[model samples]
Target: MSELNTGDSIEELKVTPDKYVPHRYAGATGDFNPIHIDPEFAKMVGLPGSILHGLYVMGLVAKTSAGAAGGDPRALKSLSVQFRGMSFPEQEITITGEVTGVEGDQVTVDVVAAQGDSQVIRNATAVLEIPPG
Candidate 1:
């Protein structure tokens, strides 16, 4: 890790949610919506198949920000995002973040998550508080 500065790029994080991720995530979050756990039901509702939970993707964004801040999750102060497209399981998802501003110890990072050409999460931003040296 290097000194945080404006325009610096955060290390990218790549994840591939397994086929059973929806089922496991549902059990942990109690979000057993068929659109996330039942592929047949999701298809019936016009979705290609069961989709990954939006919060799960947001978690990745947060992880990226925290990772850029010395891997301390508590360093993340705030996060926001817009869900742009559906993401399916067993596909590779790439998360990237860029430092857009640095004011004092607060850093603002712009984040994005994509699957192939589809932008699943866009306009995402995160604020991190880095302790002064």
Candidate 2:
């Protein structure tokens, strides 16, 4: 892990297939929405496999991005993400973000998570209140 500057961009980290995140998450979140657990259900939704919850992916972005900011999660003021596409269990998704800009004690971030031609989550922005100097 490296330190995040007041105005610095972060490198992207690919969520590898070894992550194997969907089926287990379905069980954990109780999101037994067949499209998230059953292949048949996924096909019905035009998906290749069970998809991860939007919040789950958002959480990942939040934590990893926070690392880049060198701040605690409690320092977060607001964060939001849009579900642009579904993420299959074995698909590799990459999370990339940059420090974008900063103002006063607030830091603004621009982020995106994608796999291949499919952009899973987009317009992911986070506004955080950095700790006092």
Candidate 3:
């Protein structure tokens, strides 16, 4: 793995959630909100269609940050995100991160996730604990 330094950009990650992803996520998270699993209900509620859970999009941010730390899940220390907009299924979500600070083995990253022209997550941050060589 390349050494992480301040101002360095992490590799971008992209994922396309299929239409059924919301349904499966709803079952796993027990968040069966109609807006997430029922397209008709979502439309009635003003959403374009069934939307992906906000937490799910946050998970993608965490995944991207962890990947920057050599793909080690344990390296992730903390994550915070602001849900900026709704994200729908079958659309590609792009996750990007940049190293904002590096102190010893701890690295802080600023992250963002977007779909098409809309940003699904913003003002996101992740701290990772990478071991010293």
lDDT of 3 by residue, 33-118 (tens): 99999999999988888999999999889989999978898999999999989998998999999999999999999999999999
Candidate 2 residues lying further than 4 Å off, grouped into runs, are: 1-7, 17-20
Report lDDT (Cα) of residue 58, candidate 3. 94
* Residue-level lDDT tens digits of model 1 in 28-120: 999999999998899999999999999999988899889999888789999999999999999999999999999988999999999999999
Clashes of each: 0, 0, 0
Sliding window of 10 residues with minimal summed lDDT for model 1: 1-10
List where candidate 3 sits over 4 angstroms from the true fold. Answer: none
Q: Kindly state the number of residue pairs that clash in model 1.
A: 0
Tell me the TM-score of each prediction against the true structure: 0.97, 0.81, 0.96
Evaluate all candidate structures by whole-model CA lDDT and list the values in order: 0.93, 0.73, 0.92
Candidate 3 weakest ten by summed lDDT: 62-71
